[model samples]
Target: MITRLGLIKTSLIDYPGKVAAVLFTAGCNFYCPYCHNPELVSGPVPEDFLSMEDILRFLEKRRPVLGGVVITGGEPLLHPDIGVLTGAIRDLGLEIKIDTNGSFPAKLEQLRPDFVAMDIKTSFSNYSRVLPSGTAAEQIVRKIRESLKILIGNGIPHQLRTTIVPGIVAEEDFDMIIPEVRGADSYLLSGYRNQRTLDSSWAEVDPYPAEVLEGIAEKLRLAGVPAQIRTN
Candidate 1:
């Protein structure tokens, strides 16, 4: 149903123990400034972006070379046909991993990916910015919470992540996030990198100090989350 977008042939971090092809679906529901894939975010994707057919064909060719496919976004769940895409990938007998904002519980169930990466936005990331003040914020947060619960209760292979933006995300923020995602297998503290981002402000803003990040990771560890820090 949703066929338009770009694809990355490989990613080492997206899928463990496997060479993976990463699909970047167009569009998103949130406006996190540190979003690395700006082109896929609010910006228009290339007119020459590969079709879903082409992607599947490419995956078929890369089968022996790649272990699986990582279905990522601009909030992949925002695409209405995500389940169709994942179902096709699953039919290939290659594993499917989905990277989402955790904003679509029903879709997550429909896809039933082998792995899921859920972004836990900070409380400081209030609704007025990334989310619309109208129905968007409450609707999106409700879905995100439901998705988290489904992932946790169903025993899915998943990790909860928070991108640590220096001024935006504070150390105490984890106090709220960790408890909600306590049983997650992995809790990732991804340091915001400014090499590229949707907004120019991100490139200008200094990242959180490693010490601060490490301190948050320490807090996460104390919170009983098996946390790992990644600085880029």
Candidate 2:
């Protein structure tokens, strides 16, 4: 079983249109400086972890009121037992939604989640900035592209997300991103929050104004991409 890092018993917005339970898994491959959940990203401390059996019992009790389960993480696909986890949740008759960084296309295809939200940090060419050094940027970008194609080709209900970080993501980056997410169900531009970020220096950086994100969304919509701005 994957380590249960944290859980929110009830969330209205985590899984669109449903009252859901949010389960956070630990560890991530990407080192995005602006990541808010630094603890989860680096892997949870042993004492802070929750047992999977305990979480399942809570979910089983709340199954009557809960509509779905959202399996999110530093990167949930990194867990080898994620399929077993999701399968258990499905057996409870609740829908499943997953949030991923798009690094594991093969695993993503196998999950076949009811809904997916893949983070497109920036253009394919700029992934090196967030990924660890010595990482094969080209191969990972190819995997991300493959993941995007899977979501689109399989007709899966998914959304592509990008956190509008001042230095990492600029307006021009979307020009490159737009084409990749053209067929996605929607493109969501989320504003960056400078609290508990992975990199301490990033905590001092100011996020783009809401109007700026609105303008970017407008441009994407005009370009035939279903775009929306989500305030953090």
lDDT of each: 0.80, 0.89
Candidate 2 stretches greater than 4 Å from native? none
Can you write out model 1's per-residue Cα lDDT over 43-145, one digit (the tens) per residue? Answer: 6776868988999898888888888899887888887778788888887889988888887899888778889988887753353455533546767777878
lDDT for residue 2 in candidate 1, whole number 0-100: 70
Model 2 earns a TM-score of 0.96
Per-candidate TM-scores read 0.92, 0.96
Kindly state the number of residue pairs that clash in model 1: 0
Off by over 4 Å in 1: 124-129, 132-135
Clashes of each: 0, 0
- RMSD to native, candidate 1: 1.9
**Per-residue lDDT of 41-93 in model 2, one digit per residue for the tens?**
77444466678888888999999999999999889999999998999899989
